[model samples]
Target: MSMIGLVDCNSFYVSCERVFQPRLCGVPVGVMSNNDGCVIALSNELKALGIKMGTPAFTLQPLVRSGQIHLLSSNYELYGDMSQRVQAVLEEFSPTVEPYSIDEMFVRFDGFAHAPLLEHARQLHHKVRRFTGIPVCVGVAPTRTLAKLANRAAKKIPAYQGVCILHAGSAETRNLLQKTELGDVWGVGRRLVERLALMGIKSAWDLAQANPKEIRRRFSVTLERTAQELRGVPCIEMIDLDEARQRIMTSRSFGKLTDDLDEIREATRQYGQRSAEKLRRQNGLAKAVLVFLKTNPHRQDLSQYSPSLVLELPRPTADSREILHAAGLALERIYRKGYLYQKGGVMLLDLIGADRQQLSLLDTPQSDAERQRSQKLMDVMDTLNRRMGRDTVKLGMPTPGAAWHLRCAHRSDRSTTRWDELPKVRAL
Candidate 1:
């Protein structure tokens, strides 16, 4: 049987926290976003307490003061390291592993027909948890869409034991499809759900039974493929690890409001630098830089302004300084005074492989020597930063007293990543 498995980490951000602070395993916890502005991740206990995702951190002050809930700041480095460990363990279980996100992966079980899939999935789940200290749910099905439904069931239902399998064309699988709501399907958004509702297709089973030909005509070929996949006909294939990104962006809200144009410019430069670093790491060059500035929308008495500008480069380059220069120019043009700026960032767009770059007739490309020299410098800088710490070597990004640095007031140690911050065991 041809089956695919999706391993989804359970409350991934929260789980990463619990790995070091084992006491937090059963505690109600919420992970706040940049500047501790809003809740982005929650533990099961937090969800049970009716603390909805994206709730502003300020509003939860009363709960925190009463000692009813625990809060942790977003620690991307730790979470990112944990994700790699989990992915590494998962790679040992399947022939092909496709990363869906930071906390989700799809595995292709093409030729492993004789072995029981559910048992294999269970073993894989245990191995990941045992090795990485992260809990996960596995969903197994013949198609990715149905596998998504099984994953949902694995997480939502009580009896699945973190592994849910829906055999192709089985009555149990049909019942599961019938049980799933139309809006809950992966690709079905509110607009699509409304349209599907008008056509009496109110559930996954309804969509599965709909005419694929008519769906392709009335809606889109994408929706048709989804419907086909829901009925166990695979449409989407596994994406390769080196899949190119459409865009790269880095943004963050400030710890406090500011009216200074230079401060906002500096923050935009920071974001642009990071975005460019990612571009170069991926071996992609961008033709445009996008800058955006915004003020707090919540403050009714204050003047609110949100402006964005796109700067097209004369020559596409992955050089951080070049990207920041364009981003700074764009920022200077769109930035407005008087309004208190709360956030700013940069985006890289119109990206293409740097190796296969095309030069414009109006301008000449950089000499091979210069390009090689720049690449070597960037490599050395990146190496130092990774070996020492973030910003161990910098290219003009402000180190101390920087507003772009997040408000991680409740951050935990980088136990696994940083040797200086590793947890010490107590001899009992």
Candidate 2:
């Protein structure tokens, strides 16, 4: 009954990098993953250079040395903050908003007229660009599937100016669907594409015209729903509740290998802290915690070794203290006397909301006051660190000089936020 709009940012990671450093404008820059392993984000210029995604940095050494491709380590904090800003801007448009991913969102607009939809979309685009400097493409349609298709078209079509609307039962919309490729449609994976090709359903319009009953019998309920949604039948409803995460894992490769138990414990503590933060943000609690340490899996000449231990909590909690305690105990049990460990991580499982957790009568239960106190403390810590920059007040467990710091050779100074690292610009 309502129109769905899918708003997606273009080159999200690259755009985040450009936000802080305006000098990088029009440059072929890329953000690399941990260990400077590979290019995870590429600017439009770099994409034109024929550098494909997942290409290892070692292979791109020539381009780097030639000054053709600028590279920097991943700045997740900046990207995350920018994502929050974008979502906040989106919330101003619609009452119901679903943050689909780091760079995508879905909004439901019920009362907006067809003529004004373009104006509303244009205003949203201008506001986002003016405020955050991130360009976005918007797609509007009667259903989510068509919305995604319209989004792709919005990005591809120059006349739309980064906004496309596919109205239900419109001749123009039907013609666009007929011309659209099936692979571009949401929920149509490679296997489904092959099967659909066999059935002569090459385009979105063809799939929409196919008998829903036959499609359901041959493929799956998901494909049938996709077909139905394509034909203007709203089989998929907008999800208001946030999707629960199936598993929460925190792991990182070390800058250098070590066999020190204290280093391992420190790494485990940081991982647990990160996992706990994620759990709390998702409104979930973990009942099972796993700690694992491993050596480089690729090194064949050395004796390969890895060990892990799982601990079941007395009760599920999103508290960092509880998760850190469980993780510490697991690390103590799993860490061997002599094993070269390169990385360690914490995994939280069996997640549920704290209010829904079943409590034990015999075990010590956290009172409402204690729960509120813990939440307040965590919230304060999160706010302070986010406002003042990360690691402003880190736990003592994160030992210094464990050799797990990212290889950020070209790190930008926190000139605007940090008191000590102010930037120096010389005047001529």
Candidate 3:
């Protein structure tokens, strides 16, 4: 029997913060999304306080002011750095480590015996915590679907002690699945849960016992695969972690609404540059650029206008200059003069591998030397931003007090990335 283990970090974003601020470990802590808009991550204590995920900061002001709950702005740089540290620790334990998300990894323990497999999982849980200060639960089972369930069991069941291993066709596995709700199963959405419930498949075990072909006939091939996976048959193919994205989007809500064209233009330009950087990192080129502006839909009193435009690039390129120029033109076409904009974004669409771009018959052929120079310039800019901080080598100066800047007043320091922001320890 093959053994696959899932390693999932506990309250990942909140845990990342706790590593730097130990005082927050026992307190109710929540992490807010961009512009301090809404709660995105929460600790167990915060959940117990009845502060649900996606609750706006303004709604939780009373709890915050009373010092009953602490909400910090999402510091992605710290969380991403911490996630990499956890992954680095996992690589030491398994030959095949597939990152399922920033906080979840699937590892193969194919050759291990049952007893040794359990022991190895415990060691992994300990090592990740010890090395990265991020607590993780490990679930080992016959298939990836079962592995995910096992990991959840390790988290929710106190008896598991943060590690759960289930073999194929085990009585214990069936018992656990019976207790698991249909909605809790991986890949089962709310609508699917309703449909499955109507068909008397109310729990994970019920779905596992379902006929795979019947499920496919009634629903989709994807749901059929889920059923197969539930039966300890490996059907879902693991995606390569480094696979290139088909499209890249960079967007965020502004600090405040503004009708100033220059402010929106600057935001669009920044978004385009960021999207281009992502394209270069993945070694992909964008054939089209999309620029969009959105108004506050919740503000019924204000005049609303949301518009977007897509412009094809003259040539498939990952060059930020070309991308930004196209974005500016697109913005000019879609942007209205009177409406207040709350959010703006840029998307790089119709992406292809940088080396796989097809030449058009009427396209002016660029020299190899010119392409190399453009690539080199972007490389230098990216390197400088990495070595220094972001925006160290951008195309234009940002306007001071720009309304489009994110309103992250409670964001923690970027301790892992910026030199000056590193945490300081005092001798007591």
Candidate 4:
């Protein structure tokens, strides 16, 4: 019988960091979020230090000063490259590989006997680690949901040795489900877990045993599908991972709260450029741009003003110039002078396929040549940015000491991607 296998990287970001700086492997290492505001990824050693995900970096200053914990700014470029390398290795193992997330992939295992399937999973796990220097756990089961559960088991159970296979009616599968909490299940959230607890479904096994009809009656079809999935039925379909998003948003918190409109405008313009890049990457166009600003909500003593405005484009376009113009107009309308802004963002709304653009007779006709020129310009800009680093060719010069600049003091080198930053071997 065909089975699904989930290959999940263990402590993906931390592992990526360790691949370059092996010293970070045994240390309590953490990858901070944008602006180094909070911890987003942690190594197993860091988790043992009693620091949870999303713990503010400021609170961990004592640990850092004491040399008990190490925090590094998120190196997204490095992580993205590492993820691609792992995916390339995974493609060698299975023909049909579906990336569930950056750190997880679901691959189909067809026409393999039980023993061979398990052996193949073990080999795939070893090969990924050997080729990419990133450790991964493989979980095989009849359904994706079960495969997810099996993957969790592979991570948690020492006996599994990083590879687990679970058949639907197997005693091992039932024991694993019973041991798993409802909240730990793939589709079950905190709210759903609370609701399930009240319904006497405190574990994955309980949910698996619940009546599917009753689950639908009390909750949504989604929950019912989850219940069915828990019972080894595959209700979820793996859609195209490369599908265009309905909307694109790019935003970041300022390094420091600022009331300067120019600083905010610079940040907004950059965000608009990023949103337009994302829109074009998916071969889509936006009809409008939304600009939003927020004051620091944590400071209740200070007056707060959050404002947002949306400006529609003359016509749907992915041109950064048009998007940035709309974003500027929207920002001017929404920006408050007296309030210190903590964050600002641009959202590309009402996205449509670039090929499906509707022509408007009322608007001045943009000649085909003009449209081609615009596209070619955008293509060139994107290519240069991707080949080089971001902001290598920017629309406008960013002001020095811009408040919107990210605070990443502990960032590591982009050793893999940048030639100048590659690791050097010193003769001792």
TM-score of each: 0.90, 0.89, 0.95, 0.93
lDDT of 4: 0.91
* C-alpha RMSD between model 4 and the true structure: 2.1
Q: How would you encode candidate 3's per-residue C-alpha lDDT over 1-428 as one tens digit per residue?
A: 57889999999999999998999989999999998989999999999978888998899999899999999999999998999999899899988899899999998887888888888889999999999899999999888899999999999999999999998788998898899898988999999999999899999999999999899999999999988888888899797768999999999999999999998899998899999999999999999999999999999899988899899998899999999999999999998887989999999999999889786675545556678899999999999998898777998777988999988899989988888898998999
lDDT by residue (tens digit), candidate 1, 317-409? 887777888998998899777888888889999999988788556543556566677778878877887788666776674646666567899
Candidate 1 wrongly placed segments (more than 4 Å) = 238-241, 304-314, 329-337, 358-366, 397-399, 425-428
Per-residue alpha-carbon lDDT of candidate 2 for residues 138-183, written as tens digits (9 for 90 to 100)? 9999899999988998998899999998888899789889998888
Return the candidate ranking by lDDT, descending: 3, 4, 1, 2
Task: Write the residue-wise lDDT of candidate 4 on 1-428 in tens digits.
Answer: 88999999999999999999988879899999988989999999999979999999999999999999999999988988888899998888789999888899999999999988988999999999999999999999989999999999999999999999999888999999999999899988999999888889999999999999999999999988888887888898898978999999999999999999999999999999989998999999999899999999999988999998888898899999988988988888887788988999999999999999987665455566677899999999999888876767779888977888888889999877776788999999
- Alpha-carbon deviation at 328 in model 3, angstroms: 1.6
Give every collision pair in model 4: none
TM-score of 3: 0.95
Query: What lDDT does candidate 2 reach at residue 210?
Result: 98
Question: What's model 2's overall lDDT?
Answer: 0.84
Tell me how many residue pairs clash in candidate 1. Answer: 0
Local distance difference test values of all predictions, in order: 0.87, 0.84, 0.91, 0.91
